[model samples]
Target: MLQIFSVTFPFFALVLCGYLAARRRMLPLEAIPGLNGFVLFFALPCMLYRFGASTPIAQLLDYSVFLVWMFCGLVMVGFTIAVTLNDRIRWNDASFGALVAAFPNTGFMGVPLLVALLGPLAAAPIIVGMLVDMVITTSLCIALSRLDGADKHGMAVALKNALRGMLTNPMPWAILLGGLASYVQLELPGPVHKTVGLLADAASPVALFTIGAVLARSQILTVESKHAPIPLRDYVPVAVFKLLLHPLLVLLVGVGAVQLGVPLSRFALTVMVLAAALPSASNVSLLAERFGADNGRIARIILVSTAVAFLSFSGAVGLMT
Candidate 1:
């Protein structure tokens, strides 16, 4: 209990501090992009590079864990799509809604928090989960979203765009470079290593704070907007799936995988479960807005699930510990 809090408290406390600062306008909203830029472009990549550089390539290439995580994500996406379709939601909106339900905040929140709780080695599973989300889950959602409209893009094009998006994302590149260094046994010069180490050290705290600040900004926007109040029914299902069902499905799938002789480590299993329990990815709302889906509903889902994740995530970590 206290032990678990000791481990998990600082992570959420940083988030709380950031949220309060932003909510009170203590931190200027304009500064957020710079802060995010530092994390995404520099600090986080360095941290992940360090992890990948040091870890064995075989451990990083564990397909069993990837498969299990992807299976659970696909299941959630399918279930959400079916439920939304039953409600007569447009296919595009339904696909995005399903995505909101399935995709966890693995990059910003999960990576730092998991590494904090489970150590740098935990990055392996986190990265695997991110790949699953980026490649399989997101591609499928995008394909389904394209199905309803006059976009006329074939599944091949949709998948290609998704792959291109994944390649453009710096995280994967950092991971790949790190893995290459590790595989080749190339040593970074002392000065460069030290610089990367410095940036890597900054990744966790800054990233966590950025998440809190973003959440606060979202809350502020929701309050000031003139849009009609979204029905609880509209976002609640997505919230439930994001916070509860997704993790549950992952856990079940992981257990079954272990029974079938998958070599998932205890730490990796714990990391996967915790990652699944994270809030919905903030970008899902952005994607919804871009694709002309129900962005408002998706935004509300992100806000509510994130607001509730503190307790849910704490409970998850505590239980696993």
Candidate 2:
């Protein structure tokens, strides 16, 4: 357990540092976007690209893992939606609720943390999980939200916009370019490669700190303030699904796939499970707000899940190791 803490403490410590800095106004909240821009547009992409470029293309393209992860995620999403609907939650809000329950923070939190925990090879499964989230989970949620009358754009248009957004995201493109380089055996110039290495190296710490700052800005801990408190009944279910059920389903699906002769490594299965065990994506609240859903509820879900994740994630790492 001490060994597990040794491995896991630094990641959450960085987050705590950022949270305290933001909470105490030691770090300007305005600076978070710029830091996030650096991670999303530059540092993270460089890291992923290097990972993709160096790894065998076959390892990078594990379709069975992708399928199983997506299937399990969809099952969770559907279950959430159904439960919310039974409670007479409005469709738009319920769709967003399902999303918050199902989507993991795979990019900012999962990639760097998993790389630190499991090594750079872990990035492959994380990337695959990201793609599944972007292409299938997010698109489905957006489409459902539209069908629920959140947008006048219609379901088809909403889905199209989701796909378009995914395509334009720098992360997927970085992965593709890296895979292409590996496929064609193209070597980057030494200087360029060195520069990318430097940027890639910056990804983990900055991303982790930014996560803390973002959490602080969300002010999720300040339930006694002006914001209305989230109903426990509503929040607990989503939190349970995101932090517990999602990972359990992913593990079961992964193990079943391995039994069926899927070429998934034990390490890859571990990565998938760890990724699923992550907290809900912080941006789901923003999406909830955008779609005119219950943003406060979603924000609270993100906060509770993130706060509780330290124990859950550390346990996952210890169990896997």
Per-prediction TM-score: 0.90, 0.92
Clashes of each: 0, 0
Clashing pairs in 2: none
Write out the backbone clash pairs for model 1: none
Which 10-residue window in model 1 sums to the lowest lDDT?
149-158
**Residue range with the least summed lDDT across 10 consecutive positions in model 2:** 220-229
lDDT of each: 0.82, 0.82
Candidate 1 TM-score to native = 0.90
lDDT by residue for model 1 over 1-321, one digit each (tens)? Answer: 677677777877887888898988899988876887898899989988898898888877889888888888889988998877745477877888889788898877788788778887888888878877877888889888877662566567766777787777788888889889989988899999999999998988898888788767766666677656777877888899889998888888888888889887777888888998998887676567666676677777887888788788889888876
Q: Which parts of model 2 are misplaced by more than 4 Å?
A: 86-88, 220-226
> Residue 179 CA error for candidate 2 (Å)?
1.2
Q: Model 1 off-target regions past 4 Å? A: 86-88, 150-161, 222-225
